[model samples]
Target: MTAITQLSPRLLWQFFDTLCSIPHPSGHEAAVRQWITDWAQERGLVTIQDTIGNLIIRKAPTPGMEQRTGVILQAHMDMVPQANADVDHDFTKDPIQPYIEDGWVRARGTTLGADNGIGLAACLAVLADDKVQHGPLEVLLTVDEESGMTGAFGLAPGMLQGKILLNTDSEQDGDVYMGCAGGVDANITLPYQAESVPSDHQALRLNISGLRGGHSGININEGRASANKLLAELLNEINKLQAGIRLSEVSGGTLRNAIAREASALLTLPKSANPALAELITARQQQYQQEFNGVDDFIDLELVSADLPQRVMTSDLQQKLTQALLACPHGMMAASRDIADVVESSSNLGVINTETEHIYVQCLIRSLNDTGRDRVANATAAVFNLAGADCEFDGAYPGWQPDPQSAIMQLVLNTHKELFDLVPNVKVIHAGLECGLFKAIYPEWDMVSFGPTIQGAHSPDERVHIEAVSRFWQLLVRVLRQIPEDKAASFK
Candidate 1:
């Protein structure tokens, strides 16, 4: 076992250290779930685990705070599993290696899991603390937040009694997220037909990697390069050069919500055009670097000679795929006309793959409003149809419309200002949150989200700012103590 040094908010550190010792990857959170149950059992706390492994632990109000209202502290239990390719970390069994570096706590070569883990730790720390002054509290921890929101979606109605919900899942500190964008997955599959290989052709592989990829929701508007798009652009350039190349195989991107960081294509080209093809690809790489100099400094493109045992995509299909992807709109499509810093709608060309029988592409569409989301989805499907690619739209989750005048919102704002002597920044986030699901299930519940500063979530670059934990801890306690016992509310 690696020794972990305790940090501020001693209970928080203790809980965080214990959390890191368990393997809690998305869709595989049995060990962590059992650990949490065991911890609650040992404490003799009132706890309940739902059918889908959503745990709810209720803590009675402190003596002086009994008059205050009930508050639900919510956070997802699962973390996105990511690690450096060179690392031998196993998501199913190996414990996360967490250590302090430069003012942040991070995992060695793997995702830090600070995204929701810290929120989970904070809830546990508050639950275990006997001295913290607060009203009735219920800590709600759901599973599979990374891969899907199954646990959240499966939450039974009336499972929680708190009228006010404080979701500790935001990444930025000092900011209160009142609303978030709704998103849907666009899954596509294209049939493949093999063509005869030319005897004068040579196989080559093209790769685009080392781009600074981030969470597709938060970083989608940053103008950072997308590996899927870059690869398609490269192929389009090759096609434009009239290189007689047949696409063999192509695949890129991992998670739907994460920007593609790497992509590769296997192709066969005429041996006679190999020299010219090499020069053209080299020039294209240089041009791409210059074009993305402002955002992607580490981007790299490489081509290697290879031997192919069988043909991949037919020439006609290759041209169609290239044109389809080139036409797909990526990055920020429109900025909000009302809010100064809000992104109204965006699309992420998340994944592209070429299989033995078909070409596949997946896109994630997000918008602050349902109308805009549908428009983006329809536009994307039209692009694929034009290129002879089949498309399918999965059920989309709804966005949480912000309620600025909610009673709980004012209470939190007042408490925040009193505790920190500064007003917290309240706004809607472009990313998807489980709050939307919760709202769907319980329409009357009032909700708001806030958290410590966590950088690079859902990627190996994830880290938790050490200093923000204490402040977050204090803020949570303050908000709990200030909630009014009785409040009437209505949905607008």
Candidate 2:
């Protein structure tokens, strides 16, 4: 057992500790899936894997509760792979080193994977514990939720027999989420011509780091900076002042759903302009610090020597790309009129990458309505389109429309009041949850998302509250026991 197993609710922590030892980044969950399957089989529980790698593990109801409404506990198996710029960690093969600190579980300079991992572990704990009473239970573990939500999108009908779904992906501990924003990915491809480097040019790498890049959805309205957007703004400023600089490469961000924290660009400039470039970079760094202020206080901009490349983007292409990036829409676009202080629509300039043939730019557009989502997506594409780039949109998922009258939501509310002697906060979130897609397959299923308190999700600063996990587990167990029996006895 790891040191974290010593925490309260040891089973959940033990499972989570084991999960950290296995690499299960988005689209790379085969090892964890197999581990879960083997663990279930050893316990004699029934397990099934769907076509797209979603796992469904079933456990019979506790005695005398067999006739209750079947309930599904859902969480994703894959986690967002993020590490600090200075952390030497390979998410594909290396284990995440988790340690307890200040009453929370945090990974060392990498994402802790507790966003849904804790929920997944909670399900495992319930399955392994024979003392808890519950109705017919099924645990649905989806894959690739971070990258594209492949498992949720590809889930077919009739896979689950549950009438109520409890999503274990929400980050807030004292709240329940009934609705979430729908999303679509905007991919822009800008093909550019490469030209030989200008004579007597010096190559220098420009880096922007130490900015707090958070989950594009939950943290979109937080006024955080996107590294891709910042880098483009800096490069655009340089273009306005110095015409002698040629861009060789520019890239920032990793996943399309994460606000970029770091960005770097390689460019060649006339040797005589080196001193002027340094001065410009310093000025821009200070300007950004002042702009971000308390939100992103430690934004660092650095310029360093880089190996010279034989070719660079043509001056015209560089200018066009930088201009398009500057015009690209990011951050919160509109606020919800129905729910005060709720984000209704937003766009995140999530990622930018350079290739041999073209530069790929990805943006995630989210809104409460499909029309709004498409509007932002089209607007984002139009900016790149005007720059002579081709734009394509895909991976569209619908929003979970709010259902305040849902029985499950009421039960959760009542359960929280009984457990903590306080009413829980109920609201709709701007983040995308798989509950919306699950509705398409199981239209009659009532769904609600709740989880332990997690901070800094989708970033290296991610951490989960220790006490909240224990309380969340208690609530989950009690809710299962209190699931009203179905008069029809829906389970087969």
Model 1: lDDT of residue 164: 85
For candidate 2, the C-alpha RMSD (Å) to the true structure equals 2.1
lDDT of 2 by residue, 378-483 (tens): 8888899899999999999999999977888888888999999988999899999999999988999999999999999999989999999998999999989888
Error of 1 at 191 (Å): 0.8
Computed on alpha carbons, the lDDT of every model, listed in order, comes to 0.84, 0.92
Error of 2 at 407 (Å): 0.5
List TM-score per model, in order.
0.95, 0.98
The superposed Cα distance between candidate 1 and the true structure at residue 232, in angstroms, equals 0.7
Best-fitting candidate, measured by TM-score?
2
What are the per-model numbers of colliding residue pairs? 1, 0
Error of 2 at 480 (Å): 0.3
Please, what are the lDDT tens digits per residue for candidate 1 over residues 42-71? 998898999998999998889987766788
Worst 10 residues of 2 by lDDT: 483-492
C-alpha lDDT of residue 486 in model 2? 68
Clashing pairs in 1: 192-357
